[model samples]
Target: MTIQIKICGLSTPETIAASADAGASHIGFNFYPPSPRSVAPELASELAAITPRSLLKVGVFVNPDDTLLNEAVRHGALDAIQLHGKETPARVQEVKASFGLPVWKVLSVETDEDIAAADAYSSVADLILFDTKTPKGALPGGMGMGFDWSLLDAFDKSIPWGLAGGLNSENVADAIRATGAPLVDTSSGVESAPGVKDVDRIAAFCKAALDHD
Candidate 1:
């Protein structure tokens, strides 16, 4: 099966172009202030216009209320909402109902046990993002930390899941092979530094995912 790729944490228009030109299926713009990659809603809107219609624009939020979420969707023209914080299943349903777009639920997985939480969102989420769990008091993701890929060993079920947190050109193929993840996402992995996306690295990562084993 073909792998879907997403380049996340994009802040500027140049980075958004690089991701789109590199064949990314989705581009993620963060609204969380805690994230160094965060961009203002106005910038997000400007960058969103540059994206091709074929590419999906996703807005990342952290426990955002209706006003912020509405403003974000209004300005960014987000095709999807990625709730990376403590939004419950009911919240997910509300966001979906409100925005009328696909909603992605990001789950931090450390062990096989964490996979159980998927059930809570399976019905509501259009897609699930699996990322490495950070330490207490830490940000939700974009830490560049990798979990044991083997921990996903027992997760073989329906729903298209995307692997994230620590993936680059070198390891993405292996990550896909190991986890059977149909989609792979990267933020810090394809960057020269946190929030600084390397254009060449972005192209290389897209190539790596499409190349043979």
Candidate 2:
């Protein structure tokens, strides 16, 4: 099966180019200001301008208001919206309706209950992204943490979903084989430092994910 790959938290032009050149199906830009990966809407637009239309340009937000969403969509040239916050199903549907764009809801997971929680978004979100749950007071994601992959063994596949958190070049193949995830996302895993993406790792990660049988 072909596994879709998303290289998220990209802020630099070189790394963005590397991600596209490496065959990433989606490119993500952070809109949350507190995160080191965050970029202004104008800069996001310039970075997105280099992306091929065939590839998805995702704007990652954390419980964003309509104003932020509007600016990001307009200036960032986003093709999809990734809600990586505590947005409810109603909010997801609202964003989809308001922006007329595909919405991806991120569900942080640690156990079976968290995995089961995804059912609530099946009808609301265009896609569901299962990421590792963060510790209290920590950032939402991109901390290089991973939950037990086995927790997803009995997950419902009615909704289109993707796996995130702690994925990298060395382990993405195993991750894909383990959960049979159709899509895989990465951020810190391809970074040289906090918010500093490494081009070689980006290429390697894409290679590993695509080369997996």
Candidate 3:
């Protein structure tokens, strides 16, 4: 199967270009203010301007209100919406109806129950993203923490899905081998610091993900 890739939490034009050049299928812009990777709507627009149409621009938000989603969609020109917060299935439906964009609902997985929770959104969510659950009072995602890939073995695939959290060049191929993830996403894995993306790492990661058989 062909594997798709997403480089998340991108903030700069240089990294955005690098991601597209390296053959990424999707690029994410974080809109949550508390996270270090957060970007303003104007900055996201500037970065989106340089992005190629072949690549999808996904706006990442954490329990965002309509105001923030409105501004982000209008200014960022997002192609998809990734809900990385505690939004219910009803909220996911609301976001889809309001934005008229593909909605990817993130499920924080620690056990089979977490994986099973995706069923509630099978109807509304365009995509189901499995991520590692973070601690309370901490950032929701992009923390570079990975869970047991084996847990996904029990997943019923009731809907289309992708894998995220702690993926990088050195292990992305293995991740693909282990999980057969249709799409793989990463954020802090390609960063040199908290929110600083490393171009070379981005290239290597894309190469690894694409080269895997």
lDDT (C-alpha) at residue 71 in model 3: 97
The per-residue C-alpha lDDT of model 1 at residue 208 equals 91
Tens digit of per-residue lDDT, candidate 3, span 74-154: 989999999999999999999999999999999999899998898899999999999999888889999999999999988
Segments of candidate 2 deviating more than 4 angstroms: none
Clashes of each: 0, 0, 0
Q: All predictions: root-mean-square deviation over Cα? A: 1.2, 0.8, 0.8
**TM-scores for all candidates?**
0.96, 0.98, 0.98
Q: How accurate is candidate 2 locally (lDDT)?
A: 0.93
Tens digits of per-residue lDDT, candidate 2, 1-213, equal: 988999999888898788889999998999999999999999998887887765689999999999999999998889999999999999999999999999999999998999988888999999999999999999999999999999998788767999998999999999999999999999999999989999999999999999988
For model 1, how does the per-residue alpha-carbon lDDT over 14-133 read when each residue is reduced to its tens digit? 777887787889989899988989988998888888878867988999899999998889999998999999889999999999989999999898988887788889999999888999
The models' CA-based lDDT, in order, is 0.88, 0.93, 0.94
Candidate achieving the largest lDDT: 3
Compare candidates 1 and 3 on TM-score and give the better one. Answer: 3
Error (Å) of candidate 2 at residue 106 is: 0.2
Candidate 1 global lDDT: 0.88
